[model samples]
Every structure is written in structure tokens, then in C-alpha cells.
Target: MAVYQALKTAGVDAVTIDTANGFRSKLKRDPVDLVFLALHGIGGEDGTIQKILNRFKIPYVGSGPQASSLAFDKVKAKQIFHRNGIPTPRYAVITTKNWKRILKNWQTPYVIKPVQEGSSIGIFFVEKKQNPAKKVEAALKKYDRLLVEEKIDGREFTVGILGSEALPVIELRPKRKFYDYQAKYTKGMTEYLVPAPIPEKLTKSLQIMALKAHRALGLRDLSRVDFRTDARNHPFVLEVNSIPGFTETSLLPKAAAEIGLDFSGLCLKLLSMAQNGSKEK
Candidate 1:
């Protein structure tokens, strides 16, 4: 709704359709110049809708089908990060067969989550001496695979990517134990510091690393790369959000705003990018 309103306020002829039901029919009935996706999770960000849009020869904002799929799957994204020499947290993929063996050797202070989930859903943080057996079993039953990652016990930050540029870094201070689904969505649960009070050198480095991760995943247009640091301030890429939230107060827009790009301007810029991409193809 925010994206739609932004486009409308900017004098762009935009319409919204329910991708859940009869979206294809609506597209056939009413063709639009471009698609500005504000979706997340499986069928939305996991390349399902992107693939469909590609088959229809419809240009859309954000990354392509392959990049979207690769970034949406945590395991695949981590693999790309490793191959590109990008620093990410140590992680292992656990399946039903090998979960027991993997968990047995895992260090205490680790995280368990579904391989392809967003908004920090299905995430469990196992602290020292806490029995994670029940959590692991519950997760395995729900998801085909889980990711066990070494916890970076330090500050959290995120960098937004716009076209070929990286926006200012934002520091996230979640009041909860971690930035879970609740902290992310609820008001006042997490405090955001734009341009993150870190040293200028560290900020620049994080921005560069963010762009590297974005390109490494073959993502274009826009993305948000999340990071966590150790006590030594060594950064590790957590994951890449191919289609990040698109609201006025969303993290990406907040960063863009610091660089003088307002919400409506950001929306128009993305629309123009999609149009240019359509012409190129």
C-alpha cells in the first residue's frame, strides 16, 4: 500500500493486484507498464513470482528470477558469499538424517533457522547450556532443512543497495534477545541509527562489502544486506533480502532518506530502473 500510494502521489499510473489469487488473469485483463513488488516469503521472494513475470516478458523491480532464488535460500546465498570471498558466519545445513550429528558438535551459542525463511521467522537462538533438542526437532519437522550458524555476539547492522550504489549503514538495537519477527514488526522494539555511529572507515567497508554481496548474488536494482559483528568488529554477512520492505519507515527508505532520496522519489527511481531494464532487453 505504501508503494502504491507513493506511485500515485508521484503521478504514476499504478494498480495493485492480489498475487495470491487470480493475479495472472488480472494481468491479462489489464496490462501495466511495470511491476513494483512488495512481497516476501516463498512464492513471493523465492523467485516464484519473478519467474512467472519473466515468462510473461514483464519487467519488474529488484533482482531477476535466478538471483532472487539464490538470495532467498539462505544455504545457497551463503555458498555464493563463500565462493566470492565474502565473509559470512560459519554455518552448516542440517537435514533430518544428519541433524543429530550436526547439533551434537555445534557450539552452544548458535542459531537455528529454516533454510529459506524471512523476517527472522523460524529462528531459534540456543544460549549456553540451553537444551535445543526440542527446538531443533520442531524446526526439522516444519522445514526440510535448517541452518545452524555461529552466533556473532556483537552489534547488528544493515546496508541498503540502490542501483550500483550502497546507501548509508543502519545500526539495529533490538530490545529483545535478538531481532526476531516480533522486534522487526512491532513499534519501538528496535531502535535504528542511520549512518550507524561506527567509525567512518568501518562504515565504508561495510558498504563496500554490502555491494560485493549484492553483486555476488547477481542481484540488481535494490537489496538490503544484513550483517553482524564480533567483539573485534569483524563483520559477517547474515543474509541478503532481494525484495526488502517498501514503506516510508522501512530500513532501505530510511537509509535513502539520509542520502536525500525521499520515499516517493525512491519509488519513482525504481520504476524508472525497471523501465530502462525492459528497454535493454
Candidate 2:
């Protein structure tokens, strides 16, 4: 509702569709110039819908199918980041069979999360002395794999990228243990600090790392790169949000607003970028 309202305010003729029946039929009936996808989780952000749109030769806002898929899966994105020498937390991927074996070797306080799920769903924090193996193994019975990452204690920041330009960083301070699903969407559960107060050099470094992560995944139009600065003040890339939320209070829009880009203006810019076809600047 917020995204549509923003786009409408921006003078873009946007229409809403529900994937109840199928998007193909809707696309065939009412062909669109481009799609600004707002769907979250599973079938939406996991690249399934993007692949379908690509099959129909439709140009949509945000990353391509491969990039979307890679970003959606936390473990795979971390692998790409590691391979490219991008700074990210040391972690291990766990399957049900090897969950115990892997956990036994990992140092804790660590984060155990669903590899492909988003909105911070199904995330658990395990302390140093606790045995996460059994619990993690039980959790993995419901999912294919899980990502266990070293918990970096510091501040959480998210960088919004419009094409190749990195927007100002937004620092998230959640009242909860971590920025879980509830804190992200529920009002007043978190405090967002736009243009995070960090050293200029560190901010620039973070921006560079974010752009590298974006390009590594072949992301297009826009994305939000999350990070955590450790005690040593070294920033580590957490994950990339290829299809970030477009709600009024969403971090991307907030960061854009801080830079004098209003909601409508931001929407228009994204739409224009999509129309222009990949000349990111």
C-alpha cells in the first residue's frame, strides 16, 4: 500500500497484483511496461517470480533472477563475498546430518539462521557455552540448510544502493536482542539513525564493500547491503537485500529521504533507472 501510494504520488501509473491465481495470466491480460515487485519472502524474493518475469521478457525493478537467488540464500552470498575477499563474518553452513559436527567446531556466541528465509525469520542466537548442535539439527529438519555466523558485537548499519550509487548509511538500534522480523515491521520497536555517525574513511570503505557485494551478485536497479562493525571497528558485510521493503518506514526510503529524495522522488528515480536499462551511475 505504501509503495503504490509513493509511486502514484511520483506520477507513475502503477497497478497492484496478487499472485493468488498466477502472475502470468495477469501479465498476459494487462501487459506492464515494468514491474516494481514488493512481495517479500519465499516465492517472491527467492528469484522464482523474477525468473518467470524474465521468461516473459519483462524488465522489472531490482536484481535479476541469479542475483536474487544468490542474495536470498545467505550461505551462497557469504561464499561469494568470501571468494571475492569481501569482509564478512566467518561462518559455516550446516545440514541436518552434519549439524552437530559443524557446531562442535564453531566458536560461539553465534547466530543460526535459515539460509533462504528473509525478514530475519527463524533466526536464533546461541551463547558460547550452550550446545546449539542438537537444537540446530532439529531446526534443520524443517529446512535444507542453516547459516551459523560469528556474532559481531557492535552497531548494525544498512546501506541503500541505487544503481551504482551508495546512499547514506542507516544505523538500526532494535530494542530486541536482534533486528528480528517483529522489530523490523512493528512500529516503535526499533530506532533508525540515518547517516550513521562513523569516520569518513570507514564509511567510504563500507560503501565500497557494499558496491562490490552488489556487483558480485549481479544486482540491478537497487538493493540494501547490511553490515556490522566489530569491536575493532571493522565493518563486515552481513547480507544483501535484493528486494528491500518499500514501506513508509523502510530503511531504503528513509536513507533516500535523508539525502533530499522524497518518497515519490525515490520511487520515480528507481522507475527511471529501470526504464533506462542498466546505465547505473
- Candidate RMSDs in Å, in order, are 1.0, 1.9
- What's the CA error at residue 206 for candidate 1, in Å? 0.4
lDDT score, residue 260, model 1? Answer: 97
Task: Compose the digit string of candidate 1's lDDT tens values, residues 1-281.
Answer: 99999989999888888887899988988887789999989988988998898878899998888899999999999999999999999999998899888888988999988899999989989999998888888888999999999999999999999999999999999999999998999999999999899999999999999999999998989999999999999999999999998888999999999999999999999988988976432
RMSD of 1: 1.0
lDDT of 1 at 190: 98
Listed per model in order, the count of residue pairs whose N, CA or C atoms clash below 3 Å is: 0, 0
Task: Mark the 10 consecutive residues where model 1 has the least summed lDDT.
Answer: 272-281
Per-residue CA lDDT of model 2 for 98-176, tens digit only, reads 8777877887799988888888878899986887767786787888888888999998999999878999988899999
lDDT of 1: 0.92
TM-score of each: 0.98, 0.95
Candidate 2 residue spans exceeding 4 A from truth? 278-281
User: Best candidate per TM-score, number?
Assistant: 1
